[model samples]
Target: MTDQRANWTDEKDATWMTEMIYQVVVLGKRANSGFKKESWQAASSKLNIEHRVNYTKVQLKTRNAEMKKQYAQVSQMNSVLESQRSDACG
Candidate 1:
């Protein structure tokens, strides 16, 4: 088994990147605000242990930004669908 710190990627590892986004973005839902640096540091540690990959703060931040935009679009679509459903049921 390779050491995670030694086997890091060139910031293009999709699997690692996706998990980073899920960790940081999902954690915000469980808290009152943005994730602290310590929170992400812990997340990186846990992810390294579980996935044998390393994700830096900058990578996680980029993923969070990209996911937030996608989340907003999905949220809007869900809202429209709910409204259509409400109309159909009436």
Candidate 2:
């Protein structure tokens, strides 16, 4: 829950989640793809990889510019972890 991205029962992250859901919905809409059950399931899988595992760095940042601060924090942490992993291996 409190691994890094704060994917727990917190207000900030919960807000982020709500924003993300709306984003995925918007993405589907813009693509002219209806939010069918299967499509949503697939998109959810792709978006939640990092949060669910609290390990993966990949994620779909929302288009909401107001959320850039929160998104930036996550992006920074991911890059740092990636750099550390590279160092440990090489």
Candidate 3:
């Protein structure tokens, strides 16, 4: 095994730069958002489509509160996993 700091050198730097350039070119081609305006508009239209439902302010607040609670639970689980990983390694 080699020391972490000692493993880095000019060759590694050049390889990293080449990989980054390749990734950028590939991702740019895959992301057709700039060229496909009609497709983007269609997707947006689909996403923004809503049903006609009359909900009171209190009902909306209750739904928003439930969503926040679910989000916090997921975030806490992620944090626990991250801390466990750091503790196991170090």
Candidate 3 collision pairs? none
Ranking by lDDT: 1, 2, 3
Candidate 2 lDDT over residue span 42-84, tens digit each:
4445445634533222222322333667789999999999999
Question: How much lDDT does candidate 1 score?
Answer: 0.61
TM-score of 1: 0.54
TM-score of each model, paired residue for residue: 0.54, 0.30, 0.43
Model 2: ten consecutive residues of lowest lDDT: 55-64
Off by over 4 Å in 1: 1-33
Residue-level lDDT for 56 in candidate 2: 26
Tens-digit lDDT string for candidate 3 (8-87): 24443344334434444654422443323333333223322332223333333343366569889999999999999999
lDDT of 3 at 24: 48
Residue pairs clashing in model 2 are none
RMSD of each: 7.8, 12.6, 21.5
Q: What overall lDDT goes with each candidate model?
A: 0.61, 0.49, 0.43
- TM-score ranking of the models: 1, 3, 2
Candidate 3, residue 71: CA error in Å?
1.2
